[model samples]
Each structure stands twice: as C-alpha cells, then as structure tokens.
Target: MRNILTFLQESNDTAGAAHLLKTSAAPVTGSSGLSGKEIFAQTCVACHSADGKGAFPGVPDFTDKNGRLSKPDSELFKHVMGGFQSPGSPMAMPPKGGNTSLTDTDIQNVIKYLHEEFGS
Candidate 1:
C-alpha cells in the first residue's frame, strides 16, 4: 500500500523506523507495555528483521531451534542489555541495538516475542 511505502521512505531518515512503529497500534506483550514486535520495530529491526534472521553475517537466525533460540532467556536478556559480539561476526550488536531509550521491560518483551514468533 502507499502507506507502507511512505513509512519506508520516511523511515530512511535519521528517525529510522522508530517513528513509524511508535505511531502504530500494536498489541502489548507480557508485562512490558510494548510488544516484542513493537520493540523490535523500534530497535532491533535495523539488524534483525521480522523473521528473526539478522542482516549481517554471524547474526543468528531466531527461527533455527538449534541456534540462538536454544540459549536460556537469562543469557539472551543479558546479551540484549549489554550487547553481544559473536565469533566471526564483522561487528557487534550494540547495547539495546544502539537504542538507549529501550527499558528493561522492553527488552524482555522483545525476547518473549522472539520466542513466541520464532521459537519452536
């Protein structure tokens, strides 16, 4: 639709997709006010798309049960909070995907969203 195209083009600016996501009406997830999909749209989508597959090399695929999803939630939480660099990765994932505005609950919600949408 024209709306999606508008959003994609506008989102190319400094604001990125955060502006579009913040303005959308998505259901909340878990105790976090934002759904994982929402948080992802705001933060992670730059590198991790809706499929849970990353944009760069060494980015783990969420849909792969034997991959990153196998890690415990606590570890994933820590990685999201503190940032992570996988071996052989060209770059590291900055803390909160470089979005400092994200809160603890938001990270939790995104992780849960990953599990629900991509985990087996």
Candidate 2:
C-alpha cells in the first residue's frame, strides 16, 4: 500500500498538491506518467477519503452507485475541471479538486479510478 505520509509530505494543500503532482516521479502515462490511482491517491484522498466515501457530510460519496458516478463521464469531467455545487449539498467541489496542475488526462484518469474502484 502507498504511504499516506508521503502524499502528505509532498502536498499539504491544493496548490501544493498541484505542484507536487506535476513534479512527482513518473508512474504511468498521459498524466506525467502517473496512473489514475496514483493521481487520486496523491491529489484526491484528502477530501474524498481513502475509500472514496467522502470525509465531510456534503462531500459526495463516490462509492454510491446513484451518486456522482451516475452522471456521465463528461459531466463528471466538467465538474472536476470546473468545479460544482450540488443543489442541496453544503460543500462544493473545488475545480480540479483544488489541484490546478491536473491535466485533462489526469482528471480523466482519476475519474476512471473512481468508477472502477468505488462505483457500484
């Protein structure tokens, strides 16, 4: 298993995360060579939680079949890249999950990871 401490040490906030993610060692391809899972781990796990169940009350549960994944991948991509506020949710999704350095491919890869690992 990847160490959470490494991720935290590399990035403590959104901007830091973005910088670290862009400069981190290569892992896969199309996203600085980092796999979707690695990007998610380094950039997303902070708010979405390790299991993708979300850390805060208003955070959408990626694990729910009827939740965020229910939307089309394109919609998810837009929301992730541009950010969104669910009508009834208390918290809003930050653009690129606050990691501005995330490329389109990186976002897409993270989305793919969410679907494959947490989607119902």
Candidate 3:
C-alpha cells in the first residue's frame, strides 16, 4: 500500500485524489490470507471488474490513468474503509465490501494488487 502511495505521488502529483476517495467493495470475506488478486476477484470484480474497466456506469475505471488509481493510498483506504456514495448513483459500496471479516491488511494487499495490475 505504501508503494501505491509513492507511485501516486511520483506519477502525477495526485491531482484529483479527492475525487478518487469520493469514488471508491464485498462480503466474500477473503479473510484466509487471500492474495490481492483473489480478494479482488472474490469481491471487487462485481463492480471494478477483472480488466480494470468498470462493470457499470458511474464506477471509475482503474485503466484510466487520470481516474481512481491516481489517488493516494491513504485516500483510497479511507474511501474503501468508509464506503462511498457516488453522487446520484442508486447503489453505494458497502464498507469492507460487506465482508466484515477482512482485516486492514487484506485491503492493503488488494490495493497493491490493484495498482500493479492497473496502474500502468
């Protein structure tokens, strides 16, 4: 997760981080020390999708360099931790993606994987 933060700072000086935090998962409870990819697949894929393109409108696409991935890790963490209400969207992301069993480490790992997979 720290790597993600440094990368964001180095990448573009975090121009639209507030928006990312505002845009930022599920209850599969990938709590068995799941890898980031596994967690994302089990939980986030329903929305963010495996290709990093959002599965639906209003969801931010990670493949977009200027989109959600541009945000710092802290903001991303807060976004995920608290869940977010995308303006005007009918649904909101639940905290811990509603898993309730995921530790903070799990989220960190998932974030790292997200960057590695899509930050390019």
Clashes in model 1: which pairs? none
Q: Model 1 over residues 61-93: C-alpha lDDT tens digits? A: 888879887999899999988888888865566
Could you tell me the TM-score of candidate 2? 0.71
Q: Which stretches of candidate 2 lie over 4 Å from their true place?
A: 1-31
Native-referenced Cα lDDT, model 1:
0.67
> How far off is model 2, as Cα RMSD?
7.3
Residue 89 CA displacement from its true place in model 1, Å: 0.4
At residue 17, what lDDT does model 1 achieve? 37
* Reference-based TM-score of each model: 0.71, 0.71, 0.72
The C-alpha stretches of model 3 lying farther than 4 A from their native spots are: 1-32
CA RMSD, predictions in order = 7.4, 7.3, 12.1
Error of 1 at 13 (Å): 19
lDDT of each: 0.67, 0.69, 0.67
Q: Which candidate number has the best TM-score?
A: 3
